[model samples]
Target: MITSPIWLPATLFAGAVQAWRTALQKRVSQNLSVNAAGLVRYLYGLPFAFLMLGLYQWAFAPSAFPALGRLFPLFCAAGGLAQIIATNLLLMAFNHRNFVVGTAYSKTEAVQGAILSFLLLGETLSALSWVGILCGVAGVMILSTGGKRMEPADFVRALGKPSALCGIASGLFFALTAIGIRRATQEVATPDHIRAALIVLCCTITMQTVMQGVWLFWREREQVSRIFLTWRSSGQVGFLASLGSACWFTGFATAPVALVRIVGQVEVIFTLAFSHFYLREKMRGSEVSGLLLIAMGVILALAGTMR
Candidate 1:
């Protein structure tokens, strides 16, 4: 798009889109309840998903339902379910803590996803990768700790049941999304990796957006009006999300699954940075350490990928 450098334009747009999108979501979160806002977020995304699917069909010949096979759908389904559930859990976390803290806790996904993949899919990690995983896990733990709770046991129990479990589970689901997307792209994009990745992602995430929308409508029929009223804020949350997702899919298509995911892990840094400067959330001293460890872990994980 630019004479200067193709990658620079794309990279800058990608980062700006991601950061602005997060900032918008944070802004919307201010007015709407987190649960309701998450719902608003989901519902607004359906049109984009469908639009992407349509464009894919128009640009490239439509293949089978998924350019990938049946397994693609299954993996997508599982990933979708995980995404929705984890999202709700994340919203709940936001209600209890600031978005940055909730997000720091959410970084546990890097560790959980790695562990899950190792166990479920036989994905192996090297020493460096293990270190990355530990850093991410340690950061998450530090964020979740009850620093000043009078009844630490009760506090621990509360976190264990919802906060911690939800955060970790969300990470596992996010990992599954990454792995599943890669697998789908591999299957569908046998010859043309980009098309395969894009089409499968469009189909799978479209279905996810639809299912989430349906569930939200069914549950919140009364609030649907107010939610629709808030559609004005959908520009960034919905469109930007779609655009950023497309970039993410394209990035994954171009690189190794592990490497791409490593770069994507930069979302944590982006989220933390954005949360502080844009949202006025202050980072705790411990949080700074936690983020450092997570960043270290991501580096180690990237090293493992190179091997």
Candidate 2:
């Protein structure tokens, strides 16, 4: 088992940044196509990612750059592609129904990630951790369903809907993206987790930018110009995206992906805070219940990590 103190704080920071970054992305999406909005994070974040890699290497890495194994590029490519697809699917899902449902469905990434990490990377979570993940999933579902008490049949029927299917598929691909990043980090020659993460981040963002750039150029050339025209908002999205990604990559490098993901579910709480405070929304009874469950889940997951 990998034990590192850094992953906890890294994950917390990532979750907070991700909540804001997502909010920003939503605003930017109103002006651009799903693909174009998705590209904003990578294309604008590319420079920041490079800057992070350069600064970290100059300050902390060995005089020579660390060597990446053959699998590194392959893994980065796979991970980038999965993230791209997952993001676009998620954006599509947002348009189909209430934002609550889409957000709740996509939160399935925590549980799916744990399962995938176990199957693909041979990582295992304790029974308590499994329960915690389930609790988190339940909380997310409840929050998304507007905290309504649902009959078993109602729940089953809801899952069969296209919005749920899209959300679930997005979750699956996101799980794959996390696994790919963790595997790629393992292939780095350096033992410094931060450096390894930065290296992976730099490469992955570059590839994503290129892949998405080509698609946008070919299919939506006009949108490309519009994207730059709204650079003020898109630039903020890119900066936050890179910062959030750096934190996420560091968490992946330092601990099991499942554990990192479980801890990262705190993003929901962050979202709740934003909704209540920033949006001047009153907290509902159900929102409070969902919050408590998510908190309990995070606590239990942390406890399991000690075993």
* Candidate with best lDDT: 2
TM-score of each predicted structure versus truth: 0.73, 0.95
Put down candidate 2 lDDT per residue, 66-103, tens digits, no spaces: 89899999999999999999988787777786455665
RMSD of 1: 5.8
Quote the RMSD, in angstroms, for model 2.
1.7
The digit string of per-residue lDDT tens for model 1 on 29-147 reads 67665556666555676577667767766666665543457686776666566666777776666555444445445766656556655666566667776776666566555655523
Error of 1 at 27 (Å): 2.8
| Clash totals, every prediction | 2, 0
Query: Which residue runs of candidate 1 sit more than 4 Å off their true CA positions?
Result: 1-17, 30-36, 47-67, 95-105, 140-161, 250-262, 275-284
